[model samples]
Each structure stands twice: as C-alpha cells, then as structure tokens.
Target: MFLLLVQAISLLLVPPLQSYHLDNAFGNPESVWNSLYYVVLLLLFTGAMLIIVRYKVNWLIQAIMAVAVLSTLVYVLFGLAVLLVPSVDPLIAGGVSVVLSLLLTALLIVYPEWYIIDTVGVLVAAGASALFGISLAILPTIVLLVILAVYDYISVYKTKHMLKLAEGFMDLKMPIMFVMPRRWGYSFMENNKGLPAEGAEREAYFMGLGDAVMPTMLAVSANAFLSAPPLLGFVNVPALGCILGTLVSYVVLMYIVVELKKPQAGLPFLCTGAIAGFLLGCLAAGVRPF
Candidate 1:
C-alpha cells in the first residue's frame, strides 16, 4: 500500500523531461542535437551497464549508481531553484545551481534511503518532463514517442538488449527506475537474480523512468504549444487529452503487470493512448486533423 502511494506521488512530483526537450527542439535545431546528445548518453550508459553485468564487478556498479543519483539530483535542484531564485542571469543561476545540487548529491551519497531515492526521482522526472514538453510541439512529441515505442519493443523483445539493460541497472540501486519491494527488508542487490524470470509473476515491480517520461512528454507538449481552450486548470484541449490518456495508459499497464501476469513493452500502450487522446482533443477543439 505504501509503495503504491509512493508510485502515485512520484509521478505527481516529477514532471517528465520530454516537455522541456520538446520546447528546446522547437526553438532551434541545436536543441535537437541536445536531445540526440542524451540519447548518446543513454547508449553510453547502456554499454557501461552491459560491461558491469558481464564482469559482475559489484563495486563499480555501486560507483556508477552513485554518480547517476548525484547527477540527477543536480539537475533536479537546479531546475527547481532557478524558478524560485532572485537572479535571472544564467551564470549566477548556474553557479548556485551547481552548489545546491552538489550538496544534495553529497547527502545522498552519504545516506541513501527509500525516501531519498524517491524524492530525487520526482525532482529529476519533473525537470526532464518540463524541458522536453516545452521544446517539443504536438507532432514532434508524437513522432518521438512512436519512435521510442518501436525501439522499446525491439530492445525488450527482439534484440533482448533492453532486458539486459534492466538487469544491469537494477544492480546499480539507482532511481532511474521505479523500485518497489513486496516485503520488508528486501534488498534489490541480493534479490537481483534477473528480470523477473522472463515471465514469472512477482510481487515487487520496477519500471524504467523512461516509460513514464516518454508518454508524459506528449501531454506536456500538447498543453504548452497547442492554442486550444483550457480544459482543466488552464491546460488546453491537447494537454487535457494527453494527461487523461497517460493516466488511462498507466492504469492499464499497472493492471496488466499486477493481474494479467504478463510482460509487455509499455511505450506502445502509452503512445497509442496518447495519440488517440490527442486526436480526440483536436476534434473537440474543432481543429481538423492534419
């Protein structure tokens, strides 16, 4: 029950990075380069993870996990603090941001509890979501989501690289993915026997943050760029639709994980839901489908 609440709260606290990335991409082609850079980072991360898994070096895994957690904390703090701080200059903001982020990161390195991981995850998720949402327009977000879904399918089912990625990441004990334990004193490190036995049902669950972030990118993008009337709390038709669709998709996915006892690539379901909702929103707003 607590874990379930944590999941919901985590989603609420962290906005995905997709929206901010989208906004930047919409602003300039350079922004697309920036997005591509992250992909490179992810690929690099994937490679390192493979190496870590292949060799079974526990200490290096822990070190990488620490670095990832710390880096995420930096971005999370900087993004949120920039909004509240007095100075608007990028330089001053950057300095203060670095200091604060490092402080938080240092704290996590010293002591990492469940609360700390979840808090950092929420902060990072929000930063990423806002960044991508603002940069990506409706069409781009849709395209990105579709492309990612296909990639996820290939990675998870065909190439089988994604499962490897998941296994390696789980060993790191990072919050890049949602972590839930079915029972008390369950150690992710010890129980990390691999990605749930390939089809076996398990009480605990771990979902890559990417799964959550990718779909929400469309939601935030639709809201930020679309000119339609606000449907809920100043968000426009597209935004409302995207949010509803995402929640619908999340619920469905969670249900499948819990009740259906099946393994599935989440992006396909999420993207489908978001696209359908976006179209419906376009119709409601009297906008012709392009």
Candidate 2:
C-alpha cells in the first residue's frame, strides 16, 4: 500500500516538466528527438530489469532504482528552479543536482521495501510524463499514442516477448509497477520470482510504468498545446477535459481488467478517453479541428 502510494506520487512530476519545456522552447525536431529519447529510456529500463533478474544482483538493482528516483527529483527541482532562478544554470544546478541525486540514491540502497519502491516509482512516472508531454505536441502525442497502442497489442498478443520484460521486473521485485493484492496477507517479498497466485481468478494486479507514462504524455500535451479557458488554478479547458477523461477511462478499464479476468493494454483506453474529451471540450468552446 505504501509502495503504491509512492508510485502514484511519482506520477505527478510530469505536468511541471511539460509546462517548463513548452514555455521555454518549441520545435518539431525537438519533439522528434524527445520521442526517440523515450524509446531509449524504455529499452534501458528493460535491459536493467533483465540484468537484475539474470544476475540476482540486488545491489545493482538498488543502485539503478536510486538513480531513477533521484533523477525524478532532479526533474522536479529543475522545473521549480525555472520559476525561481533569474537565469537558468544547467551547470551550477548540476552540482546541487548531483548532491540531491546521491542522497536519494543512498537512501534507496540502505532500505528498499515496498514503500520506498512505490514512492520512487511514482516520482519516476511523473517526471517521465512531464518531460515527454513538454517535448511532444498534440499531433506527435497522438501519433505516439497510436503507434504504441498497436505495438502493445502486437507485443502482448502476437509476439508474447513483452511478457519477458514483465517477468523480469516481477522477478526483481522492482517498484516500477503498481501492485494490487487480492488478499490481505499477500506479500511482495515472499514471491521474488513473479506475482504470487492468490486464487482461481487472480492473485495480484500489476501495471507497468509505461501504462502511466504513455497516457500522461497525451494529458500533458493536451494541456500544453490546446488552447483552453482556465478552469482551476492555471489549468485550462482542454487540459482539464483530458485529465477527467483519462480518469474516467482508467476507472472503466480497471473494472474490465478486474471483472473480465483479462489483461488489457492501458494506453488504448486512456488515450482514447483523453483525446475524445479534449475534442469534445474544443467543440464546446467552438474551436475547429485542426
């Protein structure tokens, strides 16, 4: 439960990063490269998980996790500093960044229970989403979402190799996933090989980090790119619409995954809801489709 909360919190780092990137600069090439960068990050995560699983190098795994967690905090700080600093100093900020990153890394190394893992997962998810959101415009976000949805379906249903990645993470007990235990006594530590079986229907629930990241890219893109009247704080109509839409879709999908007793690709549902809501909001505002 504590770990889940950590993961959820980690997911929040994206909005500010998106806002920062958009406010600072804009270009198609940048967005293209940003998308490529995410691909690399995904591959890196997969590789790390594979290595951890193969070697049973718990220390190495902890180090990687610490780095991920600290990197998220750095992104958060970078976004916050953007609002405060007179002039951006990626260099001077670099020093402070290293210190903070090291401290978080140390903590993860010292103690890595479910709570620590979940907290770090949430931060990493948020940071990744924000960066991607800011980097991608609406069109690119849409393209990315569509492509990934197809890829996810193919990988899960056709190739079946994606399960290998999931298996790797499950074996490592990495906090890079969200866990829902069916029974009260279900223990993550007990089953290091993979998710433990609980009953006839299902033993536990886990959603990969990508599930959160992929949808959020669209949410942030909607907020940053689509023009909308403010609804609350600085958030606008399209952004709010996307947020609500994603949440609604998430609820529906969770129900399906739980009740139907089947695995589901998250982005298809989440992105659909977000895009649909954004379009609806735009229509309500009398904005024409581009």
Candidate 3:
C-alpha cells in the first residue's frame, strides 16, 4: 500500500516534473538504445560495488552511500518544494531542501536506527521510483525491469554475490533496505549480525528498497506515457491495473516467502505482475502501452 500511494503521487508529479523538463530521462521516451545503456551502466556500477565489498573498502562504501542518499533526498525534496511552495523563490526552496537533505543524510549515516532507516528508505525509494518512471516510457521501463529481474535471479542463485552485497550493506548500516521487527525490542543497529541462514528464523524481516522501486516505475510509466482518461485523480486505467497487479503479486510473494523461507528474487514476480496487469489494462482501455 505504501508503494501504491507513492506511485500514485508520482503519477501526479509527472506534470510538475515536466514543467521542469524532468520527464524523459534521455529527452526521448521510447529509446531502446537508452534503455540498453542504462542496463550497461547498472552492470558497471554493480561490478564496482562488488570490488569495493571484496576489498572491504568500508569508508569508500559509506562515503558513496552518503552521496547517494543526499542526491536522492535532494531530487525528491527539490521537486516537492518547488511544487508545494510556488510562491517562494525556487532557489530558496531548493536551498532549503538541500540543507534538510544534508542533515537527514548525516543523521542516517551517524545513527542509522531502524526507525530512521525505514523513514529515509521510504522517501528515497519513492523518489527513485518516480524519477525513473517519468524518465522512461512504457517499453523502455519494461526492458529495464526485465533485465533487472533476470539479473537479480542470476546474482541470487547462480553467482550468489547479491547475498554478499546484502551482507556488506547491512554491516555498513545502510538504509537501502526496509527492516521490520518480528518481536518487540529488536535493535537493527546493534542486533543485526548479518543475513540469516536459509533455515534460520530472523528477528526482523528485510526487503530491499529496489524490490518496491522496480515495479513502481512501470506504474508510473503507464500513467505518464499513456493518455487514457484519468479515472481517479491522475490515475488512469492502465496505471491502476499495474498498481493492483503489483499488490496482488506482493501478497503472493509474501506467501512464497513464508512457505519457502529462503531468499527469493522479487523483481521476477513483481515485474511480471506489473507487465501482465498493464497489458490487460491496455486491452480493456483499447490503448497500447507502448
């Protein structure tokens, strides 16, 4: 539901983002080449992350994380401030957001309590999801999701390096994943030793922020790129379908997690749900998503 709300808001933000010429990341919405470039960029970044982890470059990793957190907050806050405070000077709004984002990023790095992590993680996820959604149209977004889902599967099962990355991230106390306690008085800062074993029962449940962000891009894309009449607020039929499909898939994914009790790639299930729902919605609306 949190994801849904965020994406819905993102759909609305598309127009304001467009006012700032923020839509279409490459200045072209349906560029297959741009999508491929994005994938390659992801691959390179992953390789760099792996190397940093392998070398135990904790400071470098933390520094990188800090910059990333600041940038994400800046993007989210700048857009929001610009929209909400139209009377205020744009520079002042932007300055205020940057200052606030800096403080939040500092706090996240310095403290990193569970509540703090969850709070920052949600804002960051929402911002990233919405940014990518408006940036890519339906087809390119689909391509990105498909490639990510496949890569997630391979990195989890075949290479198993993703698990390692998760551990490194946890150890660094990064807020890139959401943490929920199963029992009272659990401290992620102090008690999070590492990723639990396959059979181990964890004190907390963790979901990668990316898991939520990936499918959301599709919903945002559907809303932004397609010109179906708005059914509720800014939501169109196709975008609504993607949202519902993701929610349904989330339920199924939870069931699978409870039953299997092992690490699973979420993008496969989530991306498929979003895509399927989108196609069905396109059919019902008599419009093409692409």
Candidate 4:
C-alpha cells in the first residue's frame, strides 16, 4: 500500500513537474546517452559503496546518503511549493523548500526512526520518480528499465554485492529502504541487530526505494510521451495500463518473496509487466507503442 501511494503521489506531481517545464538533465530524453550516463553512475556508486563497507567506513556512507536525501527532498518540496501556490516567487518557494527539507533531513539524521524515515522517504521517492519519469522519454525509459533489471539480477545473484550493500545499509539504519513492522511496537531505531538471517522470517518487511521508483518511471513516461488519448484526466490509456500491470506484478512478486520465501530480483518482473501492459494498452487504444 505504501509503495502504491508513492507512485500515485508521483503521478499526481507529474502535471506540476511538467508545468514547470522540467527537462531531462541530458538534453534529449530519447537519446541512449542518458541511459548510459545513468548506468555508469550506478556502477560507480555501487563500487564506492562496496569499498566503503569493506573498509568499515560506514559513517561515511551515512553522511553521503544524508546529503543525497537532503538534495532530493529539496527538489520535491520546491516543486510542490510552487505547485500549490502558482503566484509564489521561485526564490521564495526555493527558500521555503530548503528550510523544510533541512528540517526533515535533520529529523532523519537525529531520530532515525521508522516512521520518520518513511515520511521523508515517501517525499524523496515520489519526487525522484516523477523527475526521472518526465525527464526520460518512453523508449529511453524502457531501455533503462531493461538494463537495470539485468544489472539487478547480476548484482544480487552473481556478484552478491547487492546483498552486502543491503547489510551495510541495514547497519546504518538510514532512510534508503522502506520499513514496515509485521508486529506492533517494532522499532527500527533499536532493531540494531542487523538484517534477519537468510530465510529467517523478519520482524519487519523491507522494500528497496528503487523498487517503487523504477516501475513508476514507465507509467510517467507513457503518460508524457504516448499519443494515446487521456483515459482519465492527465493519465493516458497506456500509462493507466502500466499502473494496473505494475500493481498486479507487485502482488505476484510479494507473494513469491513474502509468502513463499523465495527471493528474486523485483525489477525484472515489474519492468516486464509494465512494458507488456504498456504495449498492450497502446495497441488496444489504437496507438503506437514506441
């Protein structure tokens, strides 16, 4: 439910993000260069994380992540401020957003509790998803998703470095992943014993923030780039199809992992579902998929 809420919030923010004429960091969203840049950055960051963990420089990781969170929150809050008050000056909106972002980031740094992390995390995820969603066009977004899916599989199963990274993040107890307590009164702040043993039933369920963000990019991209008529408000037929497909896939993924205790890469299932649904929806709507 929380993951779904994040995507919905991201979709809601798309119009405002578009209203501000937010463009991709790389000039053309359709270009493959944007995807290449993203991959290179991801590789570098992952390598750096592994090295940090190997050296036991966990504090450094936490600091870098804190900075990352603050910046993402600023972008989200700034966009929302201008969205809610059209007449507000950009400078003022930016100022207010910074202050609020600082406060929220501070809370994460200080308290570092489950609910606090979740509150700030939702903002960061939605903002990042919407930003990337609109910035990358349909084809590039799909390509990126496919590439990341392969990468996720390799990192998790082949290299197993991703698992190591998760252990490091768990030690930090930061806001990078969403946390839900299976039992009442479970406290993430004090659950410092580290992640449960492999195949052990965890007291709290954890989902990566990326899982929510990646699938959402496809939905946003379809809405932004597809020629299909809007099925409801700003959501086009293809985009809505992606949403439905993503939700269904999420259900299947959760069942496999949460219920059956089988661990698998999430994006392969999610991206495949979104792509299939988007294409099917496009065809049904008498529109081109690409």
RMSD, each candidate, Å? 4.9, 4.7, 1.5, 1.6
Given candidate 2, what's the lDDT at residue 34?
A: 55
How well does candidate 1 score on lDDT at residue 275?
82
Q: Which regions of candidate 4 fall more than 4 Å away from where they truly are?
A: none
Give residue 98's error in model 1 in angstroms: 3.3
TM-scores of the candidates are: 0.74, 0.75, 0.95, 0.94
Q: lDDT tens string, model 1, 1-290?
A: 32223223233322332322323434552244444555667678777877877898867777776676556555555555544553566567567767876776665555545555555556555556655666656665676777778878887779888877677655555446666677898665556555676568675687776776777666666666567787535467765676667668778888877775556788887778878887888788876533
Model 4: how large is the Cα RMSD against the reference? Answer: 1.6
Q: Say which prediction, candidate 3 or candidate 4, comes out ahead on lDDT.
A: 4
Taken over the whole model, the C-alpha lDDT of each candidate is 0.62, 0.62, 0.83, 0.83
lDDT of 4 by residue, 1-290 (tens): 86777777787778777877875556888887788898999999989989998998978998899899999898888878877898999889989999999999888988888888788878998898899998999888889999999998998779878878888888877848888888889899888556666687877877778888888888888887778888657688888888888888888888887765535678888888888888888888899876
Give one digit per residue, the lDDT tens place, for model 3 in 209-241.
888889988888888889886887778899888
Q: Please name the candidate that would achieve the greatest lDDT relative to the true structure.
A: 4
The global Cα lDDT (0 to 1) of model 4 is 0.83
Candidate 3 clashing pairs? none
The superposed Cα distance between candidate 4 and the true structure at residue 187, in angstroms, equals: 0.7
Return whichever of 1 and 4 wins on lDDT: 4
lDDT, model 3: 0.83
Segments of candidate 2 deviating more than 4 angstroms: 1-66, 80-100, 182-187, 191-193, 196-203
Candidate 2 local accuracy as lDDT? 0.62
RMSD of 1: 4.9
